[model samples]
Target: MRIPLYALLLCSVPFMVHAQSETDSVHHSYTLSTVNYTIAGQRYQKNYTRSRELQQSTDRLLERIPGVTMIRRGNFAMEPTLRGLSAAQINMTIDGMQLFGACTDRMDPISSYVEPNNMERIQLGFSPNGEQHNASVGGGLNFSLKQAQTGAAKVWSGLAGAGYETNASATQTIAALQYSRSRFAISANGVWRRAGNYTAGKGQEINFSQYNKWNLGLSAVYLLKPNQQLRVDYLQDEGYNIGYPALTMDVSFAKAKIGSASYIYTPTGMKLKSWESKVYYNYIDHAMDDTKRPAWQVPIHMDMPGTSQTMGLYSRAKWYYTNHFLEAQFTAYSNRLHAEMTMYPKNAAEMFMLTLPDVQRTVYGIDLKDKIYLGQDWTLSPSLTVNYVQSDIYTELGKETLSSLFTGSLDRKNLIWNAGLNAEKHINGRWTLFGQLSRGARSASAQELYAFYLFNRMDNFDYIGNKDLKQETSVNASLGMSYHQHRLHIQPQLFVYRFSNYIVGQRKQGYSTMTIGASGVKQYVNIPDALLYGGELYATYRPWDKWYIQSTNSISIGQDNAGNALPLIPPFKSINRIEYTPSKYGFYAESISQSRQDRVSTAVYGERASAGFTIFNVGAGRNFAIGKNTLNVHAAVYNILDKQYYEHLDILKLYRPGRNLALNLSLTF
Candidate 1:
C-alpha cells in the first residue's frame, strides 16, 4: 500500500510544476450546482446557533438538506441517501480521503464517525461534473474538518456545551479548545451522548431504541514558510450497546480511528495557483449479537464481527490561465474487509461462516477538469476520471467457502471511467440556466460478490453472493433554472438516470437458508436495465426585516425493465420553515410532510405501501454576553402534535419519535 501510494505521489510531481506566469485575480465560477453548508462564521452562528443543531449529530443535520434523506433503523447511524441513491451508488469522503465502513449490515456509516462540533462545512454535489474524485452515479459528499484559526487577536479560545431531550431521556456533552500563534495553531474537541428507549406517538415505547457514543478529534497546522504549510488531523469515535429496533441484532461495540497528514503550497507569482497532497489511514471494528433479545424471540444465538482498514493518498493541483481554469488529481488506495458469523444451535456445535470474506481491494485513479469562459455569457466545464480496480479473496477458507457455490476463480478486476460536461448560460443577473450530462460505471462491492449468507432484516431473507456479476453503468442528464431577486430565490431541477446491468437481489429456489426462520434465500444478480428520475424545488423569501421563509419539495420515481417499481424509493416530501430574529433572540417554526406511497415492489423486494403524515416543530433561543465570555440558550418542541408516522424509505416501517422537548446551553470564551 505504501509503495503504490509513493509511486502515485512521484508520478504526480510533474503536474504540480508549470511555466511561471504573472498571477491574476482569481475568478470563482461554477457550471454545476452545489450546496455548501457553512459550519463556522456569521452564517452558521445566525442560523444554527439558535437551534438544537449545535447539539445534534452530523446525520441529523444532513436530514435538513434538500435532495437528501435518511434510512432510519434506529436512533443512531442512519444511512444517508443522495437523490434516492445510496450505498455503493454514491461516494462519501472526509477531507478528500476515502473511508469504508466495517459493518456488513451497514449499521455504521462514515458519517457516524464525525461529530458536528468538529466539522467546518459540508459540500454536496448533484452532478458527475462535481464528483471528480470518484466514478459515481448519484454524486459526492465531502465533510471538511475544522482547523485551528491562526492570527487571532486572542490566542486562546474554547467552548463547552450540554443538551437534554425529553422523549428519549437523552443527554449530550461537548467541549472544544484551540490555541493559535503567529505561525502555529492547534485544536481539540470531544463529544459524548447517551439515550434511553424512546416513546412513539400515543406514548408507546419502542423497544431497544437506545444508544451511547463518544467522539474525539485533534487538528494542528504549522507554517513551514510564508507559502508552505503542513497540517495533521486525527479522529476517534466509539459506540457501545447501540440498539436497532428494526433489525434482529444490536451492536455490542463499534469503533473507528482515522488520521491524515497534508502539505500545501501556494506560490506568489506563477500560473499554478495551489498544490495539495495528503496521506490518510483509517480502521474500523464492529461487533453485533442478539444477546439483548428475549429467549423466546431468539431462534438461535449468533455473534458477528467485522473489521475494515484502508490506506490511501492523493495529490491535487490547480492552475489558472487566460480564460481557463484547470485542475488535476491522482489518487490511490487499498482497503481490506473481513467479517464472520458464529451461530450456536440447540444440541449442535457452533456453525461458523465468513459473511464478508477476507477481501482485498486496490484502486488507482486520475481525474482532470477544465473550465472555459466562453464569451462572458456561457461557461463550459468538462471533466473525466478513470480508475483501475482489482479485488481478490485473500483467505483460503474464504475462497473454499465460495468455491462450493461458484465455479470459477474468485479474483475480479475492472476498468471504470466517468465523463461529464456541464454548461451554464447567464440570462441576466437574476436568472440562470444550467445543464449536465454524464456517463459513469462502478464495480460490485465485496458484499455483493462474496458474502456468505448475509441476513437482511428488511425482507427476512438470507442473501448469498454471486462472483460473476457484471459492472453497473449509467447515463445521467439534468437541467435546471435558478432565479434570484431582491427578497426571493427559487431553484427547480430535474434529473434522470438510465442504468444497464443493474444489480439487485433475486430469490433463489431450492436453496436452504442459513439463518433460522428466514423466509427464503436470495442471491445477487444483474438485471437488464433500470430507470430512475427525480426533481427538486427550493425557494427562500424574506417578507420583512429580520423575518425569513423557506420551502423545499422533492419527488423520485424508479422502475425496472419490466416496469416493476424499485424498492426503497422515497415519496413526495416537502419542508417549510419560517424564522424571525430580533437583536439577540431568534424564533422559528417548521413543517415537514410526505405524501402516501403505494408503489410497492411486493414480490421482488418485499416492500409495503406507506401512509402519508405531517409533523411540526418550533424553537426559540437567546444569546447573552458577560465580559469576554458569551452564553447561548435554546429550547425546541418537536412533533408538536405527537403524530405517529414513518417514512417510505424507513426500514420495516418503524414508527418515528413522539413529541419531545429539547434544551441546550453553551458557553464560549
Candidate 2:
C-alpha cells in the first residue's frame, strides 16, 4: 500500500491535545467537536468519563449523557434510545465500522458486545437526518474505540477492576501491552467479565439471570515511512445468559467474530495540502437457541442460527485554504445475511427445519462537505450526500431454493440523499448561538425484506416481514443557546423531526388459519406520517474552586398522523450532581428523577405507563504514591434509595424485578 502525505498528519495528533482544543475554545462554531452538533444554536461541551474504574456498563453510562432518556439492557445486549429511538433505527458502530447483532432478539448489539473499558471516548451524534450513515432512520450515534497511547519508551500500562451491585455483580481483568519502534507499533488488549442477574429498584425478579463475556483485540501497524501505514485488528466477544426483556427466548450462547484491516496512504507531496485514502473489511458469525419457545407450541423454531458479513472501501480528501476547509468521502459496501429455524407440522407433531436462502445487498455513496470561518467568531458548515443501492434474495423450502432476481430492487433505484447546514454565531463573550437543519433518507434492510418468523426479542408477538417496503425519508431542524460566564455555564437545545413513509411495527389485518405457524404474524407497514420534537438542557456552576454543581434534563413529544402518542416515548428526566474535587481527592454525589408518563400508543399494548421515582449515587477516589509506584482507587454506590419502579421500555418489566445497589474499584499501572 502506498501511503499518502496527509495520512501522517491525522495519525500523528495526540488524543489529549485534541480534547483540550475542543473544550477550551468557546465559539459558536461546530468545528471544535468530532461528533456532537450545536442544536438550535447551542454548543454543548463534552466531557470524558473513564470506564476502566467504572462500575456500570456502557449502556447505563450512556443514560448519563445530556440527551439519552432510557436504556434497554439484556444479558449480551443493551439498547439506548435518545428521545425514544433505538435498535434498528440507530446506527451503532465500533471504530468507525458498522456491526450488527445476529439473534432476531438482538442479543448482541454492538454496544453490549464491546467492553466499556476498551473505549477511549464516546461521541453521541444525534443527527436525525442520518447524514453520517445510510441505515440510521431514527438517528446516528458514533462510538470511538480507544487507540493505544505510547508516548514514552517504557510506557508499561494495564488495569484490574471489579464491581458489585445488588442485582448486577461483575468482575473484570484487563491488560494493554504496547511496543512502538521508529516505524512499527503493536498494541493488544484482553479482558474477561462475569455478571449475575440484576434486580430492579422495587424488588422485581427480572428473569434469565447470569452472563459471562470475554474480549481480545490485537493491532499491528507498520509505518511505511512518513505518510503511509497498514493496520490490522482482530476483535472477538463470547458470552451467554437469560432474561432478555425484548425476547421470548433466552440466548444460551453467542459470539462475535470481527476482523478488520485498513491501509492508509498519504504522499508527502500530493496535489492538495493534505490527502489520505483508506480501505477496510468486516464480518460476523453467530448462533444461539431458546429453551422455552419450542415447548410453548409457538410457530417459531427453538434453535436459531444466523450470520452476516460486510466489506467496505472508504476514501476521503480534505483541502484547507486560508480560512476554509473542504472535505469529501466516497464509500462502497457489500453485505449478506442468513438465518434458519425449525417449525412443527400442524397435525403430525413432527418438527421440520427451514432456512431463509440468503439476502445480499450492495451500497455506494458519495459525500461532500465544507466548513468556513466566515469571521473570527462565526462558522458555517454545509454537507450533502447521494447514494445508490442494490439487493437480491433467495428462499429454500422444498429441496429447491426460491430465488428472485429483480432488475430494480425495493429502494435500490431511488436516490438516497442528504443535505444539511450548521452555523455558529457569537453573541458576546458570555453568550453564543448555534443551529442546524437537515433532510435525509434510509433504505430498508435485509431483515425487513426476508424475515419470516417472530422477532421475539422486540415483543412477544410474531412479526411478519415485508419485501415491498420503501425507503423512509425525514427532515429535522434544531436551535440552541449557551451562556458562559465566570461562574456559570448553561446549554439548551430544541429540535423537531418529521418522517415520511415511516416504517412502524403494529398489528396487521388478516388472521392465520393454521394455529401452528405463529399466534398471528404482525405485519411491517409504512405509516403515512410521524413526527417528533424534543429538547435538552444542561448546566454547571462553579461558585468555588473545589465545589461545583451540575444539572441536565431531556424531554420529547412524539405522535402519529392521527395525533395519537407514539410508543416508547421516554419520560422527562433530570439529574443534579454535587461534586468536590480537591488537590488530591475526588468525590461526587448525584440524584436523578424522572416524571411518570403513561402516554403509550403502540396498538399492541395500549396506554401502558411507568411510575416516577428517584435514585441517588455517590463516589470517591484518590491518587497517592506507594513507594516508587503510583496507586489509584475508587468506589461508587448506585440506587442508594432502592426505589421500586418499572421502566416503560424495559422488556423485563413484565417480570417486575426492581432496585439495585452496585460498587466498583480499579487500579492501573
Candidate 3:
C-alpha cells in the first residue's frame, strides 16, 4: 500500500499501486487507488510519526490500503494478505530483490524487516499477472529505500527522532544523516526499538509479545556522466526475543543482511530513453524455541533453526518513439534453504535429529510491454512474460527414513507464461474509465514440495510437503472508474478470478506426524477449479476549508467448484473518517466495522467460523519551532471505547488490543 504526502495534514487519500513513465519528458506523482485523484480535486499526503519504530508491524501500514489486510497473531511479524491470498501466493521484494522467510512456523514475514524510516516509496500491484515481479495469485509488493537527495550545490541535512507508547511500554529512537555535493551523495540511517507485554481491553496481560529490534542502512550514488549514474545500498535488520502466542514457539533471534548495486542510463534526443542493470545479495538466519516463553510442564527441550540465501541479477530498458512506448526486463535469481531441528528429553534417552535436505530453486524470466496512445483520450497497454523455474534437492537421504515416507523425486521443473492487457479512456475531464484482463501462473514453492512434519498450532495439524504438486494458474479481470470534480472524489472497482490447480493443504491418514494437538497430518496438494469475486467503493467529500469526510467499503467471496466456501476469505467491511486540519495542527476521528463471516470452509482441515467487530480511533498532530530546529509532535488513541473483538484473519482469533495512547516527536536540523 502506498500513500502520498507532501505538506497537507488533512484530506482523504487512498493507498495505491504506482505506475510511472521512463521518459525524461514525463513526470507522474500520483498513485492508482480506490479513489482516483483528479486535476480539479484536492490531494493529501499521509504522515506517520515515529516511522523507525513502526508502533505495530508493517501490517499496520498495509491495512490502511483498500484490498489489503494482515494476519495478526502476535505484536510482531504480522503477515500481510491481499484479497484472501498470502505467503507464497504473493511476490515480496525490497528494491526489486526477492527475500524469502526462513521460518516454517512463519515467525518472520518479508514485510517485518523494512519500516517506514527506511522506505522512500512502495510500488504495489494488485493484479496477479506478474506485471512487476512474477506470477502470483494475490499481488506483488516492492519496497524502495530512501536515497541521498541530489542537487548542484553542496548541502548537509539530518534528523533526530524519539517516541514512546503507553499501552506496551514501547520505546523508539532513530537518526539519519546525508551529504550531497555536485554529482556525488552519501546517506545513512539507524533505528532501535524495544517493547514489553501489552494489556488487552480488559487489562488482560498477554504473554509472548515482547521484543527488541535493530536496523541500519546506508546508500551512495555517483553520476558517471550527464545521463549515466551508479548507485549502491546496504541494510541490516535484527530481532531478539520476539514472541508469537499463536504459534508453539517464540523466535529467539533473527537477522538479515541485504546489499545491492545498480547502474542506470537515461539518454535524451535518442530512440532509447532509459536503461538499468542491477545485482543483489540477501541472507537471513532465524532460530526459534520454547525457551524464550513461559516454561512448559513437558519434559522435552526442542529447538529449530533455519537459513535462506538469495542472489540475483535484474536488467530492464525502455524506449519511446512518437506515440508508442516499449519496455523489456530480464532476470535470473537463485534461492538456497537449509533447516534442522534438535530435541533433548528430561530422561536423556534416545535423542535424535532430523534435518531437511538442502533445497535450491533457480528461475529465469523475460517480460515485454508496449503502450500505444490513440488520439488524445485513449491509451492501450499490453504485456507478456515467460518464466522457467527449476528446484533441485541436494543430499537427498538415499534409502534413509526420508525416502520411505515421501514419494516422487526431489527434482522439479516448470515452464510458465503470463499475459496482461489494459485499456484506459477519459470520457471527459472529470470522469475516467479503465479495464484490465490477465492470466497468471505460479509454481509450487520449495518448502511446499519438501518440508517434513512442520507443526502448525493454528489448525492442530502437522504439515508434510509433496513433491508431486502441480502448478497454480489464475484468470483475472477487473473494471474501475473515477468521478473526480470540485471537492468530491469517488472511485469504484469490481473484479473476478477463476483458478486451475489451486494449491492447498489436504488431510491425509496413515502418515508420519508430529504427536501434538489432534496429531492430524496433512500434505500440500493441488485442487482444481476455484472462483473468487469482489468489489470496492471509496468516496471523499471536502465541504469546507480544513474539513473532510471519507468512507470506504469492500467485500469478497471465494469458493471451489463444489460450492464449498474457501478458507481465509475476508468479510464485508467499511471504514469511515472525519478530519479537521488547520495550518500547524490537525485532528481526526475514524471508525471501522466488519460484518460477521459465517461462510466458513470445512473442506479445510479444521476451519472455523468468525464473528464480527467494530473499532474506533482518534488522532492529532502539530508542528512547532524550538530554537533553530523544527519539531513535529503526534499523538493517537486506539480502541477508544475499549471494545473487545477479534478479526477473522487473526491466526488465533486473539482479542484485539484495548484502548491505547501513543506519542511521537521528531526534530530536524
- The best candidate in terms of TM-score: 1
Give the per-residue lDDT digits (tens) of candidate 3, residues 406-427.
6556688999888888777778
Tens digit of per-residue lDDT, candidate 2, span 275-339: 44445555565665555434553444456677766666667777777777877777777666677
Of the candidates numbered 2 and 3, which has the greater TM-score value? Answer: 3
What is the per-residue lDDT of model 1 for residues 471-574, given as tens digits with 9 covering 90 to 100?
Answer: 89889888877777777767788889899999999999999988778999999999999999989887767799688777878888999999999888888999
TM-score of 3: 0.92
Q: What is the lDDT of residue 10 in candidate 1?
A: 7
RMSD of each: 6.8, 5.8, 5.2
Which 10-residue window of candidate 2 scores lowest in summed lDDT?
7-16
The global C-alpha lDDT for each of the candidates, from Candidate 1 onward, is: 0.80, 0.60, 0.73
Q: Quote the RMSD, in angstroms, for model 2.
A: 5.8
